[model samples]
Target: MLVSTLLERLQSDPGRPRLTWYGDDGERIELSGAVLANWVAKTTNLLVEEYDVQPGSMVGVNLPVHWRTVTWALASWRVGATVVLLDGAPEDPAAGNLDVVVTDSPDSWTGSSADLVVVSLPMLARRYDGDLPPGAVDAAAAVMTYADQIIYAPEPDPGRPALTGSGVAGAAGNAVVGHDELVPEAGPEEGVRTLVDGRGRAADVLRQLLRVWAAAGSVVLTGPATAAALEADTARRDRLVATEKIERIA
Candidate 1:
């Protein structure tokens, strides 16, 4: 189904629980479907009107495993643009051909193209600079792979605390720490998504996790797995998801 379908559903159900980001430090960031819809609208405007990213154009995303990535990708699809995911490096031919590049860090894109426009995640979140496209509606959201926005929730709490959050500096939205949370020492930006502590088939486990989260949809893994070795698991998972279906969430 189109991405707009999800947005509409979420909008209609403003309180519907859509995205939840949990840190290892037992903290959590919850994004309601309503909020996600608005962000997607803003991101859509930035790509089309401000950057002139035309429909059918390829767009690159290089953000941490956070809601911003998900919203940006959805916005691109709403405009009929193809999302070129570059989780790692070497930059795929598809990504290189992108008309515009939206990333957390503009420096991440080493491509040579006058059309590539990098939209920093921090900029988008902190500032309201992008222009909105005329009559841009999230009609057709882009399909995303599970790892498109890799996420690892803090270890599940034996007893989930009230859906409350603590106030932290530079924290995206409201994130609260609970006794049962994983309390990740790193934030989403640091790229310390999950605790990939042990070795042995970590790649396989990550792949499985991606397939499950992506709703058994198509996915690709770029290169350069940071501290998480996400790239390794992404590669294996892409293949596995292609052959079979796995259902999961982060």
Candidate 2:
């Protein structure tokens, strides 16, 4: 229900910029609300149709703080699946009790005795070309084949578990935040453009990005930054806000 509400709000303003991501290799990607919703829909369909991931399924996301990570989280929540954020490969994969594990590193999960879905993390959302790890599903390839719109028989329950961290300290869902209070940050007047330090924890970065979108703001994220790049970014945009553990400049 919370995922549906967020998608509906995003659909209301399809043309607005919701995410703008920059990779360490200098690749840049900008996605509108509609585009993001489409990705989420396809991902949800992939989970439901391919993996049979139904409500209450535990979906592990072993990925960095990237745009696709956000899409995967939203898709899992859309189908009422509990999202488990993993910083890296699980020490004992079976010990996590995950129904499905999605990761950019297929090799890491190949030996894990659990079902694995591999994400290429391509800049253009392209599928991997060569041979994949044994018994691993190509998420980008599978997701593209799904419908862009999702139609559930019975809508997902809002009170169900939505998100959990690798540890027990990071469990939360619509029940914790409530439907009306999705994000607590102040809404940006025009739009927010912030520089996020991707080196931080993936869950923290994800929560911050969601907060920015809830405030109707766009993000300009990067993995670590050089002084020159930071200066250039600050000079180019008057509303740019830089977020780093050392110092946050607005």
Candidate 3:
């Protein structure tokens, strides 16, 4: 349902900057709806063509809250694959049925049984600089090679699970969310321009972005760049709101 809305918006507002990021390393990247859509399409192709992620197949994602991770989640859903949130280290056995695991720190998953796709967090990354495992795919490089639009039709079951987040050790767990639970449309267009603090839980951040986009809104995701500086300084935070023309902070 969310994916359908996104496809519609991509055609209508291709130039609108739907996702903007402020990196901790003094960098800013903005992805218009069309651009974001292209990345998602490419990722979907990578999942289907390279890994054959069909409906009900699990795809583990263990990465920080960033624009790239957002793309991964959307793409995983596009192909009817269940997006499973893996807690960073791969040693945990909460969800072992994952067909592929997309992550930044590939070292942790040294001998992971599932296929690994190592990702570089930077927006401009063409390929991962670090060495990958024997069968691991360099997602930064591979994603670019895939087609920019969806090549196959995917009719996923609405009753099947879309996302699953299992707790690792001491952390709280989350319940399975089916496609039916993903509401087709937001109540009304609130025109909310959200300022996202990147320190929140990964699943929560992804859900917030999905809701904001579903409402036909935009997002300004803040990395450690503004989160740390604005944490203690109200004045700085106010200036950011003014500078970014933010309507809400998520």
Candidate 4:
């Protein structure tokens, strides 16, 4: 299904479970499918009516790994906006590459190269409570945090894939052990690069994909500019897969 279809279904369905969010601090936030749709719709209104984020516009997201990022990214895509991940204020102001930058910290700055209409990430975060900013979507990305600095870790060897049984998957399958799941204590090889721990957030990824696909919604993975959204999205998906509702593809 397409992204819009998913949104429409959720909007029409008034009662389907949508999210199973696991915070980095080990917190859990559950959102019904209907609730998620309402939040996204409000977010979309904020982007369109408030932020003026029209179709084809580029919006930057700078949030940590959290559920808020997911809704905001989905909202941006819902309005046909390109979600740009920002590492930091661009080094130059003349770059003029972005239309908006979403940040959580009020003091966050992107730089002069990429001019942005800066806004608060908290604004989007509050959407869960149904609070949205007035002039949002007027910029490219929200003022969120993805943290700029990349740490290189050695990749793990690929292991055999196996089927997990009942009681084997708990708290989103954090316990299902696998050979490839191990990570090296040392850094990566001279030319090798890894996106994250490399234990395969497949469980989480699969869940998110399934939900989104079921919703048929479009999502932007902006790990380059505002990796916070990307990282958060990845983590959330991992949790969903581990929740036991996501079955491995045969």
Q: What lDDT does candidate 1 reach at residue 23?
A: 30
Model 3, runs deviating above 4 Å:
166-174
Error of 1 at 87 (Å): 3.4
lDDT tens string, model 3, 81-183? 7888878666666447778989999998877788899999987788898888888899888999989888873756677778877531111333677765543
- Cα-based TM-score, every candidate: 0.47, 0.79, 0.91, 0.49
Query: How do these models rank on TM-score, best leading?
Result: 3, 2, 4, 1
Model 4 lDDT per residue over 130-183, tens place: 233443333224322221111221122233211121122323554332323321
Q: Distance from true position, residue 96, model 4, in Å?
A: 4.5
| Order of models, best lDDT first | 3, 2, 4, 1
Write the number of the candidate with greater TM-score, choosing between 2 and 4: 2
Measured with C-alpha atoms, the lDDT of residue 202 in candidate 3 is 75
List ranges where model 4 is wrong by over 4 Å: 92-96, 110-212, 215-250
Q: In candidate 2, what are the lDDT values of residues 1-250, reduced to their tens digit?
A: 2657657877788997677776766777878889988989898888888778877788888887787888998888777777777766768432277888888877767666667888878766568766687778888778888898885522456666666665323334321232223234455443555556676666667667767666666666665443246566765333334322212222
> Which candidate leads in TM-score?
3
Residue runs of model 2 more than 4 Å from their true location after superposition: 92-95, 167-191, 225-250
On the 0 to 100 scale, the lDDT of residue 206 in model 1 is 29
Candidate 2 CA-lDDT value = 0.68
